[model samples]
Target: MIVMDSKAQLTVDIIAKVAEHKMTIVNAAKLLNKSRRTIERYLQQYLKVGIQFVVHRNTGKAPVNKTPDSLKRQVQALIKEKYFDVNLLHLAELLEVNEHILVKRETLRSWAHNIHHVKRAKRRRAKARKRRERMESPGLLLQMDGSPHRWFGDKKSCLIAMIDDATSEVHAEFFPSETTVGCLKVMRDCIESKGLFKALYVDRAGIFGGPKRCNFSQMQRACEELGIEIIFANSPQGKGRVERAFNTFQDRLVPELRLNNIKDMASANAYLKHVFIPQFWQSQIQVKAKDRASEFTPLPTHINLDDICVIKEHRKIRNDHTFSYGNKLYLIDSPLKYSIANQKIEVRNTSKKGFTAYFAARRLQVSEVVETSKFDTEELEIQKKLDVLALAEKLGNISEASRLSGVSRDTIYRHLKLVKEGGADALKRQETPNLRHKNCVDLDVEKTVINFSLEHPHLGQQKVALQLNARYGLDISPNGVRGIWLREKMNTTALRVEKSLSLLKTA
Candidate 1:
């Protein structure tokens, strides 16, 4: 005996009612939502097959296109383990290519919604500014932005990227920080590869001309020199193309970077340029422009990009033909070029030219003025001693007082004793025994630290010390590493990288 569903049971009752003349065939057909011909067929089947005919022949059979249980389990495991944070769309593509699991994104989303309880993303409401149309041709308009995110590892990195409004072609690189230099580099790279874009659209970030008020910024200077218009977006929706591109990148690039074990900015940039842009973005995502013809102007042959893209500042030359920069005096090399004193000239810092002064457009030769020190070195020592004593007095505890001051506990105790002594020059010690006074580290150890500094200029002293201690059996404190950096004049990250860039390139 087979149990019948409500529809089948209703059909049985209706045909029986028709046989007893309680209900007409028309009324049965209407109630069953079937034609009169279908009702007649049902009646005939009821007579021949009895109650069994009420049930369809294919009711218990599996669907021809049903997903396999094994495949479902595999995909679910992958979703949990590998793609827990990946976008469903990108996850589907990644599964097909990387794991050989071919499934539709919609199917994956359905499974995810059911199993993982992930809700589908709803469309955002339109902003106050109405939507804008894309440019007709690539290079006619380009959208540039920087998104600070944990693109690869835990540390946040800035991705400076530009997307063509018409084609959605993207050019981007990872930077340690979002600065005017990074912005300039992105624009330069995009312009060099795809020819000069006509107009650049950017948000009201200080990196652009936003913070300059009425004055022009370095970015604005470069754009103006290159004959490109700088368009500022009043709202994020004004430049929605690149904003949406960054949203997609945040969803897609993070997982790919993790899977590929890309950690540093260098590797991340290389992967973006060689792999993600070509294989992922261009192949699968970029769109064709409505107008096939590109509007990018060819870079002028005579234009000097070095002069245009640079950090520029104005300085007034003194009567002594000297100007101060970076706290060092630079002398205009004397070759009696008129009495050009008291006039303002542009001081430009570029990668190629280094430090150069420009009068109008002509380059001016300059020399550094190294002055003799007039103050005693003991001043710094006295200040350090004063700080330790002040901190101990403030906290009323010797240990926690100089804890963050980077001074040793013994040094703090000695200074505290001296202050209590009340001598005429109690703070004036015979001489401080720093790492230099202590036994110098072995030559091999010093070289190893210098090489490490050159390799990872961005790492802090403590982090470098920790890595060295873990990687090699190096017995060095953070202060010891800092002392080595001070001796080598590589104390700061910028100085270390700037001084070693030439050495690195040469090697």
Candidate 2:
């Protein structure tokens, strides 16, 4: 029996007719758009092999270049195991780089669909975006942004990233939340790894630019000192490169993390640095620059990243070589060669490192003043309580005041009674309570807690409790020690709120 396509069957019938002399070979060749010689060959084949000769010899045979079944199975297993959530193109790239199996993205897509029933829905049509040309060289400009996403599992983290506008190479780090420090850290990482870029293109977020009224932000200040320009995008669309990169990350990185069973920022970041980033760089996401030369400038030996990337505040040094910040006193360790007494000095504070004082661009040694006596703590607590009551009274609502000040309503009422009895001065001069709860730790321990908190403002209640137990042999519940710093107005959250209010007022 002959197995052939309709065109082949028609040609065979014509050739058989020609063989029978029913039609001229010339006319049959004309009908099939072939030469007379070709028609003669078809006729001879048909006469020799019967109907089977009409079918092509290699009709049912696999092509010589067909992918092997073993290779297909390997691809299938890899798709199921590692690249389960990755897109077809990215998966193909991963296979080529990591598994040494080169395949077209379309071919991989078809095979995946046939073997694993993987299907991709058509995307909705979007407005045509304007084309933006890439920069001529790497590190000319970097687009920076923060993507708040559930990158691991239930907890949402901010992936602060910076990508070169030319090469599309990215440097990103996961933070518990997006803040000035997170942005600073991302930029710092990029600079440390790839050298300092010429400029940073970012959104006009509060961290990049202060509230509408302010002239500059911490980022702007740091950038100015580092000799890097800060360009604020008029809109999110203006910095679409970073935004699009974020979309890809959310689509691919999330599932990659899920498959790896990564559930926290530390593990996610480790995987990102070690595995994911290297593979992604090998992928099609990054583009090669026209010029291979980098626009990033090498850092000078004298420049200290720790000093540059920090929150700076000016304080006047006391005659005794001491200064106060956030209600904590710091004394200079050694007598200054040239006294900076009563002169303003810059106090630089970093999240990782505690605090450092600088006068005339010279770093100074300083130590925190630790209060050892219980009487001093009791007196300080009384002053703090009075300050809270005064703030509450100024706000004109007890509940609002309690919420803002982190004080209990009952405590507010009792303080109000004292204020009524002897005015605000009485509240200020109020005596410490005689009896304390069993949960109350020693006054020295409380001072230590305050010092720890001031030094490490980012530490949470649980971490603070852990540090206390580890360092000082003092066991205290997190809640028991949660609001001790709040009373002293030393908590980072409260300080942030105050900072925001000040900015609003300025605006």
Candidate closest to the true structure, highest lDDT: 1
Please give the CA lDDT of all the candidate structures: 0.85, 0.82
What's the lDDT of the predicted structure labeled candidate 1?
Answer: 0.85
Clashing pairs in 1: none
Candidate 2 residue lDDT tens string, 44-117:
88889876776777888999999898988889988887777777866876688678999877778888997764
**Candidate 2: where is the Cα deviation over 4 Å?**
1-5, 59-74, 77-82, 93-107, 115-130, 192-196, 210-215, 247-264, 274-295, 300-303, 313-347, 356-507
Judging by TM-score against the true structure, name the best candidate: 1
| Candidate 1 residue-wise lDDT, 260-321, digit = tens | 98888889988889988898899877999899999998899988777777788999999989
| Alpha carbon lDDT at 198, candidate 2 | 92
